[model samples]
Target chain A: MEDPRNRQYTNDEITVFWKPAKCVHATTCFRELIEVFNPGRRPWVDMSAASTQRIIEVTDKCPTDAIVWKYNKDLSENELQASTSTSEEVNPETLSTDPETKPAKVTIMKDGPIVVEGEFKVIDSNGNELKSMIMTSFCRCGGSHSMPYCDGRHRKIGFNDKK
Target chain B: MKEKSAQFRVIENKSLEVSGSFEIFNAKGELLKSEGPIYLCRCGLSENKPFCDGKHKNSGFTG
Candidate 1:
């Protein structure tokens, strides 16, 4: 059975498949190629932002098989035709926002700050705005000495989140 | 319904402010940070770990 949740995108040379269920939010895609894998952008995958080679390289780095790619030449005729038709019809606005606004998913790094995603607001202790970031890390180690934001001190202090 | 983007505010010498649709999990994958308006320690001096405990004031943490 076909899962409607699975999506794919392609340029003239290659096709990129997205399996959201497998995503661990490791952020490798966006961090490596924000121009193409910007989570802030709808559809979140812009195949045209980079060359097919670069896209393939980054896609391979995905820790999970959440994202995968294949050469257009390798796809069957039916797949090639589907790629073209669907690629052109993509509308950024049609993409889901925050998976229905449930809440931002926060992942605490093994030795780093907390990585926050989705919809949320961060205010200072006194109620001032520092910066609104789509994805940001907050200090968890008691050694940051910064208080709220991470200063990359976790690594220095050997702060293990596993504890 | 559409979800709004999350917002984060950094304090001058205190914790970072976070609100809106978000969740905070600990290193063990536990939900240590609460949703809603929560303050996370930046100075790393909070007795509560992630939450601000005002230790920065006594420690004189400039960051």
Candidate 2:
């Protein structure tokens, strides 16, 4: 069966897999290499954006198995079958890339970072514009050295949010 | 014409201030806030969650 949350991206030399269920939202992938793992783009993982080696390096930084990759020649038969399958239901609401997408998206991931996307500006408490980004991950664990931005410290600290 | 950029403000070591056109939702895909100028907890000490509750002082939470 097709898993809606399992996404795969390819670029001849390699194929990247994204398992949302396993994601700890470390923010490592995007923060280190937004060119390839851009959350603002639909099918967020764009393998073509970087070299196979660079992609592999960033994917390796993930603290969880949320993102994985393999050489196209090394893919197992089952993986190949799953990658080629396109039977999942298409839900427009879950579509990540609609040009006219909403003003901002704040997704509080379970045990992960708060993923924010869309055009927006970040201001300091003193009314200074710190940044204007299309997408970013905010640390909810409060253990990140990057301040508001997550640095994958939640996993190390085993931070848990009360339900 | 080009539009203005959204504003996000960091309140020292306490919280993040987001303003301008934006919408916020929790992990369950529930809509929480859709308006601009919202305070998000940065110190992770908020009892109210996501939003700042001014608990950073006691928590000794720093960036």
Model 1 stretches astray by more than 4 angstroms: A1-24, A28-61, A65-99, A122-132, A142-151, A160-163, B1-6, B33-35
DockQ scores of the candidates? 0.44, 0.44
Residue ranges of candidate 2 with Cα displaced over 4 Å: A1-68, A72-101, B1-5
Docking class of 2: acceptable
RMSD of each: 8.0, 10.1
Best by TM-score: 2
What's the TM-score of each model vs. the native? 0.49, 0.58
In candidate 2, residue A126 scores what lDDT?
68
Clashing pairs in 2: A121-B6, A121-B7, A121-B8, A122-B8, A123-B8, A123-B9, A123-B10, A124-B10, A125-B10, B19-B37
